[model samples]
Target: MSRALFAYPKQAQFGRVLPKNKIYEHTSPSPALKALFVQQIDQIVWQYKLAPETINLPAKPAVPEIQIFDITLKTAELDHDVLRCIDKAIPFPIIFQLSHDNRIQTIATYKRPSEADNNKWVIDGYFADDWQPIETPRQPLPVALDLQGLYEQLLRRLLPLPPREQEALKNHVERLAQWHGKHNEYQKLQAKLNKEKQFNRKVEINAQLRRLKTELEQLS
Candidate 1:
């Protein structure tokens, strides 16, 4: 915590003059509504690799130029009635411009909470930096859609490892995942393949059958 935050000093009791009051409101919304909105914005953040930064804002974000990204409002929770009723409220990265009446106007508006703590307003000036790809490893998107093909692709990348190496790698990977608080399904499989490739081994079902037959013949 900043010393300014913890120290009030002699008589500045109404609270120190931080511009935080001029920025976004931090009131908690309904849990369901809050989760619904946050998830939608977080998707955009991940897709665009948008770096989250906190800004002190009070009003809703202003309107900004139209964005090219395809943002569908298909989630059942976000609809016209649920969203449009708030006054001057919109999502972030909005563009506000001076109008003919000498008043400012927003060309485009997003009005939902931002990608950060879900409380700040994203200003056009702040979002001016072009977006980059999100390169860091991320948890797989929860099973809202099919991921079989994606998982297969990852497996293909791992199928070259040898048996012993695969075993060690798989165990190592599982242990690493345990550190992160959850098991990663695909990574574990990848680790196995990596081990197999390292040992130059491949499982052959017919060969295993022939081995069993030889063992029975020896017993006979």
Candidate 2:
């Protein structure tokens, strides 16, 4: 049997296993209300698994608020379990990381049906290195939603770009994302260099830092 792990906000607690029935009694009247309820659920799940009374996970995560499940299960089976645990009407999004053979092979998102669409069990994003089309797919793996226009508008509001500068804005955002990723790598390397006692290893890390700095300059 595959194991499924979940993360909730820190304020809530769950027993040994998550309940398969609806945990919240009140109905959400609006999308905002629903989001708040889901946030609470996320917080509860997070706290339940990490609290001292429970599993007591490490205080510092490689990435915070993301809990990795130790149990392994088929993708279909795990999705079924997650759906059973969450309310259908609430429309909360849950992310799942599927692993096998000591490596995560797939990352999938399970979300409730949208008000404008009729399709159920839509997989928003399924990323894998060895992805192959399922001949008899159980769920619909639809194309990712395109929010470029909305994203552009938000960027414009934040930066107040001049008219007819769409391409420039796109390039700027892409470069910003690249720079942030490189900056993270730079920080990790700096930490490693500090702890590394080997002279040869320190030399290699210094070379990497020089390359990263050049890339950062290009981005700037």
Candidate 3:
């Protein structure tokens, strides 16, 4: 994965503190989720807003604007549900920057409008880069013809694999989701194979494992 971190243009900075109550008001989060928010999160800032006014890119239907949120964490790890809650509260696509102990990591889900309901958005899955020092040099935002194109490039940076030539962003995200499913299945098969004591069963498990490995290679 190339450097996924980016320096937002100063012109795009929002620099407003977003209170937890505001999110709660919009989301009406469950009690458990609310507790998680209070325990795991320290603060949330509406760090940057990428729009036609700020970035001078025409907005696409699904991506009118991209919001960058800076989240200060109380713990090193944050539950995905926390992010899900925020995404639910906000209608627009979001890119999350997580901060912990002076280190930062970028994370976002493949979010887009639902085919069945334009008012609703479907979040495919979360993708993240490893944490780095806060002062790590950041790359300038990728040049894009429109907000949708800019969103695609930003999310692509977090994926483990590069996009195939002329591939749509949705297709790229689907491919990565498939890879993750197969990877998890492979790990489970390996665990089952390790626990199998019978030689006959071992051979069967090994054969299945080899087949899965081949599939994984093709996906990669």
Going through the candidates in the order shown, the clash numbers are 27, 13, 0
List the candidate 3 regions with Cα displacement exceeding 4 Å: none
Report the candidate with higher lDDT, 1 versus 2. 2
Off by over 4 Å in 2: 1-154, 157-167
lDDT of each: 0.27, 0.40, 0.92
TM-score of 3: 0.97
TM-score of every prediction relative to native: 0.17, 0.32, 0.97
Sort by TM-score, top down from the best: 3, 2, 1
Candidate 1 worst ten-residue window by lDDT: 1-10
lDDT of 1 by residue, 71-129 (tens): 22333223222232211243333221112222211122223334775655532111111
Worst 10 residues of 2 by lDDT: 60-69
RMSD (Å) per prediction: 22.3, 19.3, 1.2
Off by over 4 Å in 1: 1-27, 38-42, 46-77, 80-220
State model 1's lDDT. Answer: 0.27
Q: How close is candidate 2 to the true structure, as a TM-score?
A: 0.32
For model 3, how does the per-residue alpha-carbon lDDT over 28-97 read when each residue is reduced to its tens digit? 9999999999999999999999999998999999999999999999999999999999999889999999
